[model samples]
Target: MLITPDISTLSYKRQLAKRFDRASRSYDSYADFQKIVLDRLLAMLPLSQADVVLDLGTGTGQALGILSQQLKPKCNIALDLSPQMLTVARERFSALPNLHCVCADAERLPFQEKSCDLVFSSLAVQWCLSPLDLFNELFRVTKPGGYVVFSTLSQGSMPEISQAWVGLDSQRHVHDYMAQDALLDCIKASGLNLLSSQLSDILMWFDSPEAAIYSLKKVGASLIAGDAHSSVSPTRWKAFLREYEKQRDERGVPLSYQVSFIVAQRPAIV
Candidate 1:
């Protein structure tokens, strides 16, 4: 089942940004899954040159170097909702010519229409209150016949964590991921032609549930649901850990992520 969030709340949006800002310093250390998905997303793109490219939600500028090496666009714009993240990206790519770092929301791009030839985002749009709004923004900024390539979490991600909280209280511990069908629908609704999309499961193992939680916290993804006040009692926490351990394998405790990779194009006008 697909879960829709009340992303319209300003407080929720602020909470999301603040959590990411606080996590800026430690994000790169625990972003292994993100890196894996990004590599796969990059592989799916057709080899071509773009005059101008926009890297939306360019966390820590992780994709900057590779994008620069591959697309070799004349200009690369790295944008993010978190100022601290942008700060880190700017410093990381400061020496690269024509690289601009902008602190801006993905849903409301600060660029002229049809200006960019390529738009790339990784594991970022899920945080937006409205995926449709984000897609629309991407479509608007993209030049006719331009491309938008992205990867995001889909439904059934982190089932181990969600399952652990099943018997616990009603408070939400994990953020809800968008259903695959819903995501495809949003892409179609944005007036972009879908080229291809694929869904896959990515798993990460930890020594224990605590280690998994720690990794997530380090990446600032733990508080993604914006449930700042939610807490688990000692008894409940113990039960949750016990439940999570049931999914352990020879590698370690498993954290599963369902990721969706999508490629779309803005049709060129005749």
Candidate 2:
């Protein structure tokens, strides 16, 4: 069974949005991991034209150019929870005539049913309070025979960080990720037909444990309001660093990410 955190509170969501908003300026630089996953996710997308494309959590509009180049959508919708992030994304893609950026929640997308021909999200669904709700929204917005491709962090991500927090206090320090089975169950229940799915263990090497944590913060991924206590004492922080050093390899500290990529489609009208 997967133990997930309760991040459904509006306050937590607002905090998360604020964190991303603050990181908007530096997100592109520190999002190396996200860029890698985005490339992999983009490669997995079947080479088919889409008249309308929706990029959920389209941080800084990274996918806009690529989607335009590959899928050649007539219209592109970039939606995000953070207005500041969307502001940056809009600026980044201002030259694109067909691009539209919207500030909206992934769980409650402000789009009509069957309004999109393709829905793509990268490294975004893991932050949702209920992945099922997001999946359902994706399914609802997708046209018949349309596709939904997404990547999310699975249960084994950031094992070293979690390990380092052990022996300190019982309070959680890292966010909880959904187990693969639990995620699959949600996908199955969402009624979208699974076309392809893959799980990968990608290790990102950092110069130090602090650097790894810093990178996460730079990318707006270090939000801990859901499962972690607000404060960590200086002594506890030092202890965590010492514990984290024990797991360092020759390449430096290893941050293991269990990434899941899934491609699903709504059934075509028969």
Candidate 3:
């Protein structure tokens, strides 16, 4: 069944694609953090025998490689929205016969319904223009008794910078993540019966605010719906830095991220 997606839900994803497409040339340097997160996510998943796994937003094929080695799925479809990102993924996984890269939207997935045993998405779904619709699409493709595992930042993500920015200036650069309770509600509404979910408050320390912003851009995360080119005056930047510094911990400035991990199952009858 073809699903027509609402553009509002994919607005952030379009912005992030621009960010990632621009950063693809330099993404490898900062991808280690993503790898760590991927490892943590993988440890939580349990795969069935030769099960087909759909890796949504599989940037650079690293996630596919990891899944292939760990889950040994019979076939892996690595789908990403950015052509540049998929190019990187295709190059990296060229030798892996099991992995195939396709450029497609996550919300309106171009795959057979109820054909996949598992649908795994990482940091990607947070950027879904319409998370509810995306989850619904995920539920559509997953076979009965199949699993859906995903991770995304919560509302508290980047509080230090967001709070400071509001005080220093009215510019909002951080994207708004779904709240834990709200996100769970969306998942449930999509018909994926929740098995378990863990919402954790995580913080990432950075040497400087510029470094933090740079890392965000490097990871293709700078596009916060309306944040195009924030032309802040020097005075505003200074004020912003001062407010941001207030949120610093003993180690250094902290980027607050409330992360949620979910493991849900599609009903066997569905």
Candidate 4:
């Protein structure tokens, strides 16, 4: 359950936090769809009156509202690296007395051992290059037999957007995500008994290609994090649009996403 210092040194996380902070004002605009995915995730949670709970990457405190209404933990820690995100979370959950918001990197959480009875994150760990490191940290913070459940994007999450970039210059504009195989390897290596591992595709239908791309960028979900885009000339924009349209599905622009969900348990103290 030890976190390596290497993850903190990666420059991507800082720039990612900055972009998200700037986009915080507009985050809710594209959040309605994400909420659907989150609702389905919530239906699976094994709820209890836990003494301590940790909500990692609690963006805008959407989950905080539900946690406060349902579990009413003695202490609910909502942690994220983005200051603006924490600001919005704090504002949203102001009425909840037990909740506390802190800015902490996902890969390296700042918590005492066995401090939480449950740990939950939604669509957040995908940002981590070392998902296992974060998973181990989750295990470390949770009490014995506690749950560490999370959901994240899988390899096929953004196929249409990726395919649209095919004709464009290939400079690896987006950050690369680890494959599902690698993710499983990390979880196994963490020494936690995994109760469930499921990956599914949530095919979100958007009105138009521009709308799809714009919404992702508006919520700071753009692929290019901390990377420079090749000069997009006026002509290239036109060509890129044409190439993008070619991959459109029957309704017109196709926006598809695949996701993974996991539920693991910390071994009970013998």
TM-score of each: 0.93, 0.94, 0.90, 0.91
lDDT of 2 at 269: 95
Worst 10 residues of 1 by lDDT: 223-232
lDDT of 2 at 63: 85
lDDT of 2 by residue, 1-270 (tens): 854445556777798899899999999998889999999999998657999999999988888889988888999999999999999999988888699898988988889999999999998899898889888999999999999999999987888888888888897677789999999889889889999999999989999888888778887888366323237777877888889899988899988899999999999999
- Candidate 4: tens digits of C-alpha lDDT, residues 1-270: 853565546677777898789878888878765787778777678866777888888888788877766777889899988899899989987888888898988777788898888888888888876677777887788889888888887776677766767868674544466677777788778877788888876766666666766667767777666423234666765666677677767776766667778888889999
Ranking, TM-score, top scorer first: 2, 1, 4, 3
Q: What's every prediction's RMSD, in angstroms?
A: 4.0, 3.9, 2.4, 2.5
lDDT of each: 0.86, 0.87, 0.78, 0.77
- Model 3 regions lying over 4 Å from their true place: 1-14, 226-231
Candidate 1: stretches off by over 4 Å = 1-8, 227-230
Candidate order by decreasing lDDT: 2, 1, 3, 4
Instruction: Compute the lDDT of residue 178 as modeled in candidate 1.
Output: 95
Task: State how far residue 219 of model 4 sits from its true place (Å).
Answer: 1.4
TM-score of 2: 0.94
Tens digit of per-residue lDDT, candidate 3, span 1-270 = 855445854665576677678877777777655666677787888664547988888876667877787777888898888889988888888888777777888878888999888888888888776779888999999998899988888887877777777745565667778889999999999999999898877667788877766667676767375443366677777777777777767888777677788899898873
